[model samples]
Target: MRVTRRRPEWRVTAIARDTYALEQKSPYAQCVDYLLVGRDRAAVIDTGLASRGALRSVVTALTDRPVDVWLTHGHADHIGHAGEFGAAYLHEADRPVQAAHSDPAFLKRLLREEMGAALAAVARPVVRRVTAIPPADYRWFGDDQVFDLGGREVTVVPVPGHTPGSVCYLDQATGGLFTGDSCCDWGVLLHLEFCLPPAVYLESARRLLGLQRAGAFRFNWPGHHGFPAAADLPEQYAACAESIADGSGVVRPRRHHAVVRYRDVLITLPRTYLAQPVGRR
Candidate 1:
């Protein structure tokens, strides 16, 4: 995993966590951590792979400002190791989803059936090493909520699509945007969670674009695909929506052709991943 540093005292570290597939193959999504340095307190946005302790070690390296863990969404890849932190915060709307994710058995089943058995192996350590973070400790973030972290103020921008209650953190001090999973591969593929329809997801993407237009932010960092330095994300999203509306986005071999019609806009398993088995299941 490569660790890249951002401008103005913020560093983004990509972890080496891989998920197992049903065919027992390993696939990596390049999870990221956004570490912010403030005069009073420091904050970490999104903890990567719980079992690996990536988030924990990163905090230890930075200043001991009262660390707060902020979740872009409650997807296992983003918040799987949330319990490891003293207290974490996420959008209140995703509370139920987070609750479901905290369940070991459910996660096990999810990996075994949906994701793949190979991923289950990697997930096991994360599940077993689970440290339960209290629900009360987590505060619900609203749209345009600003957290005053001493010298730095990280603004919470709600971009729900990939998941309900998904959020992104904007650091005004650095003009850096922490995009959960909304912008990937240069805003090509926008993955929608089951809770959100494809159309709704497009709307959320537009909201983020508006923020960028306002000129408060410039850089884009996602939960899985690392960082993107583009200013035309709004345009990309519009194109994605257009492909969905039209019939040009579909590809062969995959079943959800209509939903993921745009080759550039859909987030699907890479050929390297789908071709390989997840494990010895």
Candidate 2:
């Protein structure tokens, strides 16, 4: 897999296809969006970021399928550009944020001051202005929500703690989970804002562990860079959460794009557990 970092967005390419993300440089990385392609129709997992036009271009280049967008949460960066799409979907709890995307100026101010200035300069000469996708375009996700994307399917799993309505999209056909910042390589560790207490995040992490143990997924595509495969990450996350819950886990601060090494820390409860079964506890 190749990760391409554009001016304010990141594009991940796999299997000769691509997924887009927006991460303007800031103390806190705002939001990360993804565009999942299919033969007939395309699904964009998140849309609020600096890459609204880029996201649209990538989707169009991949396929002419009617695009469907869903947000992991309703943060400004995750829902801002959603208005450009014909239809956008997000959790019911995030509808207000999505509705706010209709107002371009409001959305612009929400961006980091520097990013807003850059964005303004780009939009001045652009022929089209940002528009809003109608409310009818939204889809509310309940538990076990299923989206049929022709041959492949995306299951909406409520991954709270990060946000009241935050979710992860699991593509059964690919064994990949589109984790929207539920986990990431970024250095910012502000759990208080995006999620509940550390315990809530831990439970969410444990839930992902159960799915990994069940062989539900193999690849983990997080909203941010440096994601791990299910076979490599699930057990580790579980172990970390277990340790944290018991006051035995030590979270070593790592760099923004540091390469994670298993030996640096214990590989107790992640998807790696499935990879090396002979050493199982």
Candidate 3:
């Protein structure tokens, strides 16, 4: 039963000076993609999901300057239209598995994990309709690497826990950190097969905490729900990961996995738990 309906528009906003955000509210969760307009050219950060359709036309309406695409990580939701914009920069560490994350079976399992049994019956069919992950011209970079977008610069700070090549972009001009699946106040899953252990994740959290403490950035601009999340999410998440790493956090069973909570944040652990082999840092 295909329910035909209107396609949702990208909720556009000027998140910062010369920086625009196009947000897609997916059936299961919300996703955001950003466009940063620099003096010479513009860069699109992450591409949301393919369901949102091609973004180049939308971006062209925003700026006439040449454009570049950058992926914060390789998650299906984040890199959906990456190939639509030509070659994009992603950390080499994520190159191995990033391309295969968008297949229908993977999305089905992921939606099941996120939406749970309640919606699985109605959602699986929708997931199955998704086309294969598009092939991309990928240019990989490493941590602390800076991309000069003419006048402005964005540095990639690798956070491996979410995915081995997961990173947060520190926008030099506005002091905003474009953190993708990482450092979200909603829920952070460290249980994926490609994710690093809690101990490794904690290190990334600590780095964010330190960057926050030093005023490296003003807000944590996540790829999901809620823009500029609570000021102390990094701190709380650090403690949560720490508790899990040390086995002191109270863990509760949740469907296929368990979760450890710190305040309003929940860090889901893999069923294999801490026994999963560590990935490259």
Candidate 4:
């Protein structure tokens, strides 16, 4: 679908006491970026495929505190407006994708290949609008790194499945976990070149499950669709992974890729990974 200029602009919804979700309704992808406000500074998670000025304007209207942008992964939709923010951070594993996506030529190829040529033609303008800001210099952060936003602290947990550097941020004060596409209620996309195997993703799912069991996080906030995923989402994703490992899931073809359905989650991956030994990363 073509992105029209008449579509709704960036909108912000308060998700928690100090957390807000910025929903950008783009024809290419309806993405939700987040802002966690704190006493001293604020943290922004994921910059959607919106115009850099629009994202910056919405963020500035939300908080006056100093803001830091933390990317969930290196996807084009997630990092389009990243250059608008200062103190941006991303994982080293995603640097290659991030760097590649910053180029307009690479982005054009991605849109044509993944989203289809027809959609790519319509989305070219939107892509240009979002990419107006040059790629920002990103500092790297690893797993278990804690970002102290005054009284609130968000811990970064590495969950590399959707992409090599996919991560979830756990809010220590609110018991809310921001899972960026690693596990979403809608579905998980593991068919990309940078995506990890289902077995490797299963391990990460188990890690999130362990955190839930230990009361580290009470709720999950995914990067897309709605907020506060079902409590059993982690379990459901884990079961899906298990089914993929056991060769019990029914596979179906979509576009040019194959997807395996298990429980409420749909996993898209290469058939080669499914044929490999289970639990192999």
Q: Indicate which candidate wins on lDDT.
A: 4
Candidate 4: worst 10 consecutive residues by lDDT? 272-281
| lDDT over C-alpha atoms for residue 41 of model 1 | 70
Q: What RMSD does model 1 have?
A: 9.6
Clashing pairs in 3: none
For 1-281, candidate 4 gives per-residue lDDT tens digits of 99757655677889889889888876566788889999999989998875634688889988999888989998877887787888788988888878777777777776777779667675678667756676676998777588888988888999988888889999988888988888778688888767887887888899999999999999798888778878888988888887887777766667756788876778887756545554453
Residue-level lDDT tens digits of model 2 in 1-281:
99987563444444324344334333233445566666667777776444334556655765677888877776655654565566666777655544554456655554433245546654432212344332335667666688876776788877665566777888877777877756544321223223344455567777887887798877776665554533545455545545545555434332211122332233222222223323222
Error of 1 at 98 (Å): 0.7
Per lDDT, what order, best first? Answer: 4, 3, 1, 2
- The deviation in Å at residue 271 for candidate 1 is 19
Better of 1 and 2 by lDDT: 1
In order of appearance, the predictions have TM-scores of: 0.74, 0.64, 0.88, 0.91
Candidates 2 and 3: which is better by TM-score? 3
After TM-score superposition, the amount by which residue 203's alpha carbon in candidate 4 deviates from its true location, in angstroms, is 0.7
**Residue-by-residue lDDT tens digits, candidate 1, 1-281:** 99986322224343211111001011333466666767877666776544433445546665566777788878766775565566788988888767767778767776665556546676666566444433326777667688887777778888766667878888888777887776765333332223554455667777777888888787776665535535565557756655444434442334321134343445332223233332310
What lDDT score goes with residue 104 in model 1? 81
- Per-residue lDDT value at 46 in model 3: 88
